[model samples]
Target: MLRKIAGIIFVAGEEGVTLNELAALLNLSPTEIKPMIEEVQQTLKDHPLSPIDLVQFGERFLYVTQADLDPLIKNFAQSPLQQKLSRPAIETLAIVAYRQPITRMTIDEIRGVSSQAMLQKLVSRDLIKEVGKLEAPGRPILYGVTDYFLNYFALSSLEDLPPIEDLALNSQTASEELFSLKRWEINLFDQEE
Candidate 1:
């Protein structure tokens, strides 16, 4: 199955393919095929000598040459996956992801700071968007993570997210230490709702 996936990716070339396509082709759901796709990705990465690499950009998986072997190719462009989110943006994104369909006011309340700019930035980046209006006074807009969010983090779905309890710090100091991380790999989960 891994070999088949590799072959399909190799043949797909720069056009690449999507998990949905793979699942459909294999007569499986995206959840059923995601692990196999990950296995194929891991196999490619485990071999240091292999010049190829598999990367997920949004919803598409493209075959890219290893950076170490870039010189071998005539002209190798950079991958869009190289794009990164800021720490605050990541934090804001995490809040929305975990407690999705939440209002900006709610996010601001949780973060203990105004999330207006962060919300705007996230919306502009297509990472998060207004899902609907809350059925309350003023009808504040609710925010939720987009499909691009899952792809950016290489997550198959919200189901793939770890449990919040696993990441919760018992002490305030420990929580500060965790949040102070310079570069987060986005192993985020839910918070108390």
Candidate 2:
């Protein structure tokens, strides 16, 4: 019972909570807590308001907002109001969305100003996050749009962005390009069509 309550609090109070933190709060080793939570997960497997589930990231465990919870689990789903972005944050977001996993240096080069401060703000808001580090000197961190960003933008996927090729092509040219690419890949002598 206490584990369940502590788990709920750990998830509700922050964007994410590591397993070490959860163990400390529950007065158990992470090893013990792991299986306990798995059991708890099973109990709530059929629950309606219990849409919240544990997210495992490497060795860490955190409670993340699950979009599936929605109107059914209103109380848990009702996130504290999100912070609004300044104009600069919005612009940076656009660049990352279109060219994701982009390094901070590249973002600054494109925007003409260092974006450290704005990037921090966006990270805090959970709209953008460190996807991974670039395999370059100093292993600079790469930023990318989050699932939350896609949800906010109402996009099915990044590919849904208006194709740049479409913008540059007239109808005839666009049709010709598609036909050429299709024929170029198709094998004329293949047994199957």
Candidate 3:
């Protein structure tokens, strides 16, 4: 039961599993799963391999870096960030972020190549999402940067985005805006909405 609970917790990652959900997956009642998880929590107390503890945030739970690991985390954060996307993916993301609610054809026209794969990857990363279908023939999906994208970039709102006129005027290549969703971003996305 402890192993099962731990597996569920790990796979859930920042998106935590509810007690009811865990119980259903384990084929046990919530009452049963609750106490079993309590036992597992106790076992993790003062654990040496991983000092991090499980945290219950209302209906959700997650394991975060222990305070002792702060310096390591800080160093990791200080290092230059890496790109999760290819050049094409970065280009695709910028177009979507700036010209949001834009159709895929528009992105393709700007890039001069089929962007189907890049669009798929952006959607998979939750950086971009299909806001709705466009009014055009075939009603192609309209894409926009997700709340996850906005938070990842540390922008408070869409209004924080630079004007579209600036982007069009600059003709700057679009590599400047690629960012992976950070752990905190994932956590925020996971909370009940």
Candidate 4:
């Protein structure tokens, strides 16, 4: 039962699993779930070879890789180049960070290009994730920065991000200028051809 509970929490990922939710899923009461979680935690603690640990956040429990294994994991998980975010990924991240709980359609509109691959990369990196779904139309998934994002950037909260007005003004002005220049160059090239 403990192993099954741990497996459910592991598969839950960043979303986490609440005590009540787990109890309902496992066909047990919340009282029964608590001891199972403790048993799981004790089992993992006793087994130093286990790579994962169970943690509670609010009313939820999550399985996270043991912090002691960071160095070993980093050594094997990423190459030097892969450690850095690509330009498009950074841009997508910035957009999500500023305009959180936003949908892919909104991100594409802001970027003026498809950001599907970048979004997937960010999700895989645990930088951003699906926070919820929009109510309109097909109910597109809404993306938001993760707790890992805050920790990685050393931000206390989303409010710690630089004021969005300044960023928006600068970004909009620069993109408009770049777009006009690109359009002019394309027209000139077409005329020459």
In lDDT terms, which candidate is top?
Answer: 4
lDDT digits (tens) for residues 11-42 of candidate 3: 99998888999988999999998888787777
What is the lDDT for 33 in model 3?
86
Q: lDDT per residue, candidate 4, 96-161, as tens digits?
A: 987898999999999999999989978877789999999898989999999977866679999987
Model 4 clashes, total count: 0
RMSD to the true structure for each prediction, in A, is 17.8, 19.0, 15.6, 19.8
User: Given candidate 1, what's the lDDT at residue 90?
Assistant: 72
Whole-model lDDT values for every prediction? 0.75, 0.66, 0.75, 0.79
- Name model 1 segments beyond 4 Å from true: 1-84, 169-193
Q: Pick the candidate with the highest TM-score.
A: 1
Instruction: State the local distance difference test value for candidate 2.
Output: 0.66
* Candidate 1 lDDT tens digits, 1-193: 7777778878888889999998888788889879988888898899877778899988888898877777746332232223355677778877898889899999999889999988887787678888999999999999998887787667898777655665565435533433444534432222111
Query: Model 1: what TM-score?
Result: 0.47
Sorted on lDDT, best first, the list reads 4, 1, 3, 2
The deviation in Å at residue 130 for candidate 4 is 0.4
lDDT of 3: 0.75
Q: Judge candidate 3 at residue 160 and give its lDDT.
A: 81
Lowest summed lDDT across 10 adjacent residues in model 1 is found at 184-193
Q: After superposition, which runs of candidate 4 have C-alpha atoms over 4 Å from their true positions?
A: 1-81, 167-193
